[model samples]
Target chain A: MHIPDGYLGPTTCGIFYVAMLPLWVTAAKIVKKTLRAKQVPMLAIGAAFSFVIMMFNVPIPGGTTGHAVGGALVGILLGPWAGCIAITVALVVQALLFGDGGITAIGANCFNMAFVLPFAGYYIYKAISYNASIDAKRRVIAAGIAGYLALNLAAGLTGFEFGIQPFLHKTASGQALYCPYGLNVALPAMLGEHLLVFGWVEAIVTALVIKYLQKQSPEFLEEGRKN
Target chain B: MSKGNNFIEYSIAGALSFLKESIFADEYATKEGFLQSLDPRIKVITFLLFISAILFTKSITISLCLYAICLALAYFSNVNMWFFLKRTWIFIPIFSLFIAIPAIFNIFTPGEVLFTLKLLGLKLIITQQGLFTAVLFVTRVIASVSFAVLLSITTKHFALLKVLRIFGIPQVFVMTLGMCYRYIYLFLEVVENTYLAIKSRVGTRLHYKKGQQIIAWNISSLWHRSYYLNEAVYNAMLSRGYTGEPALLNDFRVKSKDWVWLFFTTVFFVILLYLNRK
Candidate 1:
């Protein structure tokens, strides 16, 4: 899911960077107003939490293990705004130090996983769980569904971004200047993998974590309940 | 070390190995070498110029030449050639080749037929434009990644994050990034120790249901611990007269040689641009 360098045209990457600017600013403002001096350590620990979350290998039905994005879980656990910043920090580390993702694609990758994934998952859980108690099974169900849908949505947008590269940047004779796969190939390939395999992984992880935290660390869930 | 039959050991080893890998990579930064001596801010800017030159050029020859420059820069920086190659080549550029494989066929790209192969009772045509496009894509990816990897290896990670100020990033965000880097190691240790405790009690190859339970326990316990750490850590800083604004150490001093090298890189970039036009 990490888009490497050279897969996106400069224009596309630039647009994503421009688009993410205001969102980052707004998130920072909201977090500062809410957490005050606590935002630094809070967001830092949250970011580290999300970073290590990806290292966990959970067993799925098929005997093979997979890791969860944990974006939605973070959103649900630490409100969406802080979650965005947390995940953004993690993505930056992954891009710069680990090279799990491309430096140029940081903006695009954060927009998808950090922004869209968390907010979509958070709001969907909110709407579905609607006034349910912190420990309600309904909340667990909401987290699961939110995780599935949010991941799919992000994956779909990633495909759409890759699909448009050929249309936006191509030679006169139609040779793609960036990603060669058009919508016909890119969209399904990205979505198929996520929808079939990753979505389930995300759902189970999100739901299970929510379930565990509800019993083990309800205090934190109560903090998330505030905003 | 990254893979194993036991998920517990795998996760623990993977997380701790990242810590070890990071420490190992920092060795290159500590060496007295070309990139290590330059001010990190300047190093970042010149690397950006190199990447821009690589990305903007359409020729595979030019991209490969830029990649060679990356190797040369790495050598002068005291980074081992094999380590650098393993770091860069085994990354996304290799995966980019597989992605390019499909793009080289006639079904995805239509162009001059370079050759045809019959596989599984089906005729496949490889197109010249498709092949060139694929090669160009892979070359560009490799060059860009090499430059990025070189920059990171030659500069300390914290210094790298601090240089984000060069891009006008918010001070708060930059501080948080530094903090994130700091505590990631702490939690990584906690992950290792916790897994070790679990393995001692339960051993490897737990039931899948038990694995989920343990994973859930890991996630939830980490969250609880992080929340508690946040409160304690913030208060400790406050007692030490901490405020929102940070006073950071400013140790970087630009030398004349750095300026000369910057100028040389600009000239080299202009020459590449000229040749690109040719």
Candidate 2:
């Protein structure tokens, strides 16, 4: 789901950077007000948790293992605002220190994973799990559904971003200067794989984690539950 | 862990060290190399400038030239040529192969036909324009990735974190990021130990359902540990006179050499931009 450096034009990257600025600021502000001064350590640990969460390889069927983005899981655990900041920090670390994601595309990658995934997942889970007790099975189901849709939604946006590159930036001879795939190809390619494979991985992991937390420590789920 | 075909296998060591090999090794950053001598802020800014020039230019020649300069920078920075090559090449093929190769065929970008090949009794036309587009996309990726990787390897991670101030990232977030960077390794060790215990206890063959249960247990326990640690860390910080506001030390200074390097990079950037417009 991480867009590499060359796939998107400078304009697209610039636009995302601008677009994410307000979201990030808003997220930080809300997180501070919500968590108070304690937000610092909470967010830092959350960031580390989210970062290492990606390293936990879950065994799937057919003898293969997959890692979850854990964006949705974090959002459900820490609330969307805090989750967004934590995931953003993790992503920044990944891009800058690890070079997993593109440096120029940090804004774009964070927008997809940090903002879109968390907000989408948190809200979807909240909407579905409304009024359910912390220990309810409905909360676990909600988490799974949220994970699947959140990942798909983020993948869709990424595909759209990549698809527009040819139209936005191309040579006079119609050669694509950046990502060459049009919306037709990019959208289906991104959405297809996620819908089939990764979305399920995310869903099972998110659901399993929620189920465990519901049993082990239901207070973790209570933060995002408050009206 | 399993040698069997259907056993649930997780390469914990490989997955955990995936980032550590690059971040923690710091083999090149410690060396008294050319790039290591410069301020990290200057190096990062210069790398960003080079990347911007690469992105702006539509010319494959310009991109490749910048890519060459990136390699030279890495060489001067004391990064091993083979190691650097492996890093760049590994990422590029997995990424560009999917996105770039498709662009080379006539289906994506129809243009003057360069050649045609029969594949499975079907004619596939390769176009000059298509080839140019693909190569341009790839070289842009290579140039940008090389420079980004170059900056990452030559500078210490903490210095790079402090350099985030230049980009206007909040001190708190920077502090958080630094903490996150530090704790990630700690958790990595925990994860390593946990996996090792699991392997020792369960051996190679485990059912997929059991594996899933183990992962859930692992994640939840991790959350519990991090939760307790966060609270303890906060109290520790309070006892040590840490306020809500964080103060990160800036030990970087723009020396004469940094200025000289900046001047040359600016000149190269301008020339590249001019060439890009043509």
Candidate 3:
């Protein structure tokens, strides 16, 4: 989910920015080394694709519809580094253009959605689907499970970020200056929703997309150095 | 003939309406207004300073003052007041309220009990300090989101990208951002057409399972097509003498009015910071 500004104190936001700086540098290096000049457009298109994907309404059970974040799907198609950059670009655009997420919290938001979600999902998918044939049903299951788990992981981290604010930042009289909930409250609130609803939607979306690609355009998956 | 089918159709309609509204919102950014008239770089820097000032201060009075300033700015910028308030308050307050609700309960945040009640053999107390903290949290979040919404609704998206470039964002990052902005509209069109084509063929209702499968297939095909499209786009750029870096035709010039605005904003921020320390 998008964490708006003022939810986390400046200290937490600052630490995340510092933590993300090196990862961003490394991602840029990887993108430069692996992708050729012609493939640069893929990065841009991928980011745009991630942005537009959220607009799509996916049919779920019980006659309702929802959307996926598409971070894991990007990671599965293009490698995690590319996914990171693409999703990060999309997040930046959302903040600056639409004000969906906080500008100050961009670093923390990207750390969750772009870095944590994609990389964790990608690796989890790889680990589960390893040794299975590319067309195996197990691979689809792997994608779904990866999506489910990666989202929860990001959710848990977000909870930690919000939960710690009360403990870490407080005034002289012990009133919370930022988010007021402790870990006990924040973690469960975030984790419950994702684990119950959004996680399943993300899982199904990732699995279905991967399955379609496997049937129609398997080459895209194999050629892109997704591992 | 099924309720599920109607729900799906309604959701698709809702999605399209939301897409149209977003596009409509973009039209406001191009209109001549106070914020629209400022160089985007100056607007970006000044708004960012305002956000930082809001974040740095713990005083609720200062936060509300900043929120009022954002409202004043929006008023001067020719933005619709109702639209601005609705955009800022509708989502952020409700979302923050959900986050802040638990803070008001005594179990999570300890303080003097404002109200105590026994329900189902359980003691529930709303704490005075918790209520204060929750309100403070909501106020700060509201103030922060107000500035963000003001900045976005007044500044054109392309101008925002250019401001990012001016801030020394990496060329690759800026390039990707520029291209992404350019292509989002095209991709949205593709998505709309794909859905419309499916609707035309299937009429009002189709088997739910089949509909999902078709949507998945469409997404995959879109991805595949995008690969080829990227190559074509790159070639087109090359043909037009495009280099690696994007070159914009409009040069940014900050006039004396921008400096005056900047000075006043800086003075306000300094005063807020001083008052916050007190």
Best by lDDT: 1
Poorly placed runs, candidate 2 (over 4 Å)? B1-9
- Separate clash counts for every candidate: 0, 0, 0
Interface RMSD of 3: 2.1
What C-alpha lDDT do the candidate models reach, one value each? 0.87, 0.85, 0.83
Model 1 lDDT per residue over B1-278, tens place: 12233778678778877887788789999999999999998898899889888767778888889999899999998999998998898858898898899889999898999999999999999999899889989998998899888888889999999888879887778888898888889988998999889888875456666777788888888888998899898987788777878655768889998899899999999999898776
User: Considering every candidate listed, which one attains the maximal DockQ?
Assistant: 2
Candidate order by decreasing DockQ: 2, 3, 1
- Candidates sorted by lDDT, best first: 1, 2, 3
Clashing pairs in 3: none
| RMSD to the hidden true structure, all candidates | 2.3, 1.9, 2.3
- Stretches off by above 4 angstroms in model 1 are B1-5, B274-278
Residue A205 of model 1 has an lDDT of 87
Instruction: Report per-candidate DockQ.
Output: 0.61, 0.65, 0.63
> How displaced is residue A90 in candidate 1, in Å?
1.2
